[model samples]
Target chain A: MDEIKEIMLDILEEMTGEPMVKEDLDLNLLEEGLLDSLDYVTLQLEIEDRFGVLLPPSEYTKEELDTPRRIIDVIADKMAV
Target chain B: MSVRFYDGFEFFVLAAILSAPAIWLGVTERRIRGYGIFASIVVILFVLKDSPKSILLLAAYLAYELLLVRLLLYLRSRGKAGKGIGRLVIALALLPLILSKLAEQLNIGGFAILGLSYMTFKSVQVIIEIGDGIISDVDTADYVYFNLFFPTILCGPIDRSRRFSADADSVMPKSEYLQLLGDAMTRFMTGVLYKFVFANLLALAGTDRPYIYGVYMFFDFAGYSLMAIGLGNIWGIKTPDNFNKPWLSVDMRDFWNRWHITLSTWLRDFVFSRLLRSCMRAKLLGGDRVYQACMCLMANMLVMGVWHGLSANYIAYGLYHGVLLALTELYQKKSGFYKRHKNETAYKAVSWFITMNLVMLGFEIFAGHII
Candidate 1:
């Protein structure tokens, strides 16, 4: 879980071009403009590459993957399965 | 003698009379789904009675799609749903709509079914979801009701099957139903004002001007959408909203998120997202993310435009927005200045101004002004 969190933060920081802190985990990535439509897809792609878990955008909504914590949790859950 | 949905005062009067029982059930906290379905059938029959051709077409279309969906579900249950078969079924489901569009383009008569496009969207969504194993079972009555819900039969805010079923299957509390009724009344009245008063006035004021036409389009379509939503609420279905403050959008992408929201989101989900995922998986454009994104946007917008109609003007309108969105995507991602000061008020104001003009220009192309 810790490793997943670290890697998710790193991916987000690279996409947003800003350093992400632990406090930013609960922040809404979409509302905060950290991710737009394309960036969201890219984030999923990066997660797929790193974690080997594919999250189809259609299956999961924007809200389901909105926050950094939620993203990490979803990825981790899929990985566990 | 084809009667348009939500068109005349008589239609609303008839709708009110037909919906009275369902509304009563809703207010009394009774299950309204059965009555709602009955009312929808009543309205659909009345609307299509004058046109035998349309009634036949609609019936045939419904039967075809329902059977197709059932077959797909059966296949999925047996664990024999191959990707090739799934894709073929989707294409087959789209065949009627594609043929209808082609017939219209060819000036052939007898294939013009009202609400075909919206119905196709609902059917395709179900098929895709079932293929993905998201939806396990589909009740026949619920499927029919979801597809033919009269309020949204002609035009739509395009409610999802799962969401619609959840609302339909559950009973709303009296207090909650009453609150929804009040909101529904407000939305319906506002729709009346928008469609009958404002849109009519705009039309009378001359839609020859591009900006006038654009605003007119909003009032007219949004008015229809509001009334549909209001009616859906009365029937205990929380129909999705179709518009927000689109005129104030800060970019092309933002505009899409605001305008005809359901359709844009539908395309985004089923078309754009899927397309992008496949492209990225294939490492298309040699793994160039920007180019891949641009290509997907263009293809997505073209599908949208062609969905409108196979006309030169409509194609141009779609491509125009595609270009604008691609450009917006590029600017936002690549511009250093944009990154530095994007959150500032002045920058957003300028962006809003630019986006509005570009939107109006697209509307002009849609209206066949510049094509």
Candidate 2:
């Protein structure tokens, strides 16, 4: 589980090329407060590759990501599965 | 000059002549894409001086795959299966592809090098799987089949390595070949119907509005994807679906997932997840969950934004959904408004919104840029 988180962080850093230092879970994805959608899907794909968990299209409902903490738990759950 | 120029067209004639032999080998010997490359060779031959594009693309992919094999071998040699080196290995492998495709969209000249964009995605995806310990080992024939399969040549529903190799290694009876021939014939006819009848009848080429153009594009592309998938299916091979009801997705992310199901899944597994994980870990060290989710969503979208291209709109197009996902994440966390409302009706509505917006907007952007 820890390894998966470690892997996830490594993947996130490589993809974003930016530090996540001091950011909040519900903070806007874009520096400008409006995160773009295409980037989101790209991120989802990257997560799948890094973790080897296949995402069904239905998994990505708006309610899914509700918070950063929940997101990690979700990812952890998927990785565990 | 004219005679020399005609030399290129002459190759097509030759390719046609050679295709028969390839068919015989594939059907009789059951060689699959092993013999399919003879067809690829024909395409490459036509692209002669165009060797720069093919050579550059081929060398990069070859080097990437070879390095991947070596790293995994080394890791196994060191008995390091769960060591997490696989993540870095995949990152290293896919970086070139993401860069090259992005460069092409920027019109950086060489990035649009023929089949480079699609093929690179396939190989890179394969390398990641191999590194992750998901894929154990595959024979040479299977590897060849995965890379060189012809039906998937021009555009693709990028076949997974294991799935592709499995199909290649297996054999079907002669009756199956006849069925495939019938299916191929029917599909080819559909392609003809779309190209000659639907595309031209609708005069789809005469449009700028994405919604209108989207319909035509669907027929045009679905036609080809169908033909390819049909050809594969009949031959006792498999292909992942390239499209579902894409316009039906309720949000940008959903739309992307549905639109090019194969590419979307490939990108999600390899690229998007990494971005999210890094963001969550780096900044949110026990920070608010909603806050971190947003940060991850944003970071992910930015990479996706760039992955699509260096263009203003293409980048915006990527960011557009990235923003929505982040907002949606934030929204869901902050309010339980939609929580109790969850039912089939609500689900369908949301799905429709996402799909419709993507179809309406996506077609517009591609039409604006590509057309």
Candidate maximizing TM-score: 1
**Model 2, TM vs. native:** 0.66
What is the clash count of model 2? 56
TM-scores of the models, in the order given: 0.95, 0.66
Give the candidate number with the greatest DockQ: 1
Q: After superposition, which runs of candidate 1 have C-alpha atoms over 4 Å from their true positions?
A: A1-7, A46-54, A73-81, B1-3
DockQ for model 1 equals: 0.60
lDDT tens digits by residue: candidate 2, B116-136: 556667666666666555666
Model 2's DockQ score: 0.05
lDDT of each: 0.88, 0.59
